[model samples]
Target: MAKPERHPRKTIPAASGPTNSAEEAKDGKDAGYNAGMAVFSYIIGGIIVWSLIGWGLDYLWGTRWIVLLGALLGAAGGFYLSHMHGLTRQGSSSGGSAADRGPSQDGAQ
Candidate 1:
């Protein structure tokens, strides 16, 4: 019969070399999750606030279309603001070197 192995295999990192890459991966995912949450919150918050304001205005003026108008404007404003402050900012920060930008489209060849 074959002899059993002696020492058990260790899971590494026990000697203080390089930590597992899983930690870094988890951190990146957490950051992305947080960013997503923030974006969602911004969109939801903007729309709700504006919609409420519009509803109040309609109640005061006894109008109906204003609410619809307000909701639409609120959605547009929310999306615009979210993209501007969240996606655009993050993209710019992580957008590698300036050379990554495509060549300018100026007419001067």
Candidate 2:
């Protein structure tokens, strides 16, 4: 005895366009999500590290205000780092090169 063969009920056609807007939009969303995550991580990391240092200093100095100062400094440092790393701003000077932006009108290279 032989068993019957199975077949797919439906088939999907391939896309024929030069560009895929859906894919591009997905990529843009992913990039934005990644940037947001990076910013969050930077801020959190700074806070943790600075807070730890402040805690240690406070313990050694027998004081309770150093931890607060450390937390504030960490926050400021994190924001500065994020801005420097281009995670805080969009389309800023840290973006792509001149060629990516477009041709240079100025004669200098």
Candidate 3:
């Protein structure tokens, strides 16, 4: 019987540490979740504070629209400020060291 030819196999580099791609992805997800939660908290807090102020003003001025408008503005501003802060912090942290090392698929580089 004739022997069959075997194809060569490809080899991949082994991981050196306990961490892997899945763990990194999970960590990223957790960080995003935390950031989102922080923003939500800020908006909710602003809504409560603004609602009180709006109610007090409406009571004195006898205008209902002012309260609604104030609450809306407060919520928008709070969300914007929170989001900006998050971006600033993320930018600062992501701009240094590891992120600048190479071309990363996740855009961290």
Please tell me which predicted candidate would have the highest lDDT against the true structure. 2
TM-score of each: 0.60, 0.64, 0.54
Is candidate 1 or 3 superior in TM-score?
A: 1
Using TM-score, give the best candidate's number.
Answer: 2
Which digits, one per residue and each the tens of the lDDT, describe model 2 over residues 24-75?
8788789889999988888889999999999999999999999999998998
Cα deviation of 2, candidate 3, in Å: 92
Q: Provide the lDDT at 84 for model 2.
A: 94
What CA root-mean-square deviation does each model show from the true structure? 10.8, 6.0, 15.2
Residue 2's lDDT in candidate 3: 90
**lDDT for residue 54 in candidate 3, whole number 0-100:** 89
Task: Sort by TM-score, best first.
Answer: 2, 1, 3
For all candidates, what are the clash counts?
Answer: 0, 0, 0
Superposed Cα deviation of residue 67, candidate 3 (Å) = 1.4
A best-first ranking of the candidates according to their lDDT comes to 2, 3, 1
Error of 1 at 95 (Å): 6.4
1 or 2, greater by TM-score: 2
Stretches off by above 4 angstroms in model 2 are 1-19, 91-109
User: What is candidate 3's lDDT per residue for 1-109, written digit by digit as tens?
Assistant: 9999999999999878637799887887888788878888888888888888888899999988877877897798788889678632554445576646567678663
RMSD of 2: 6.0
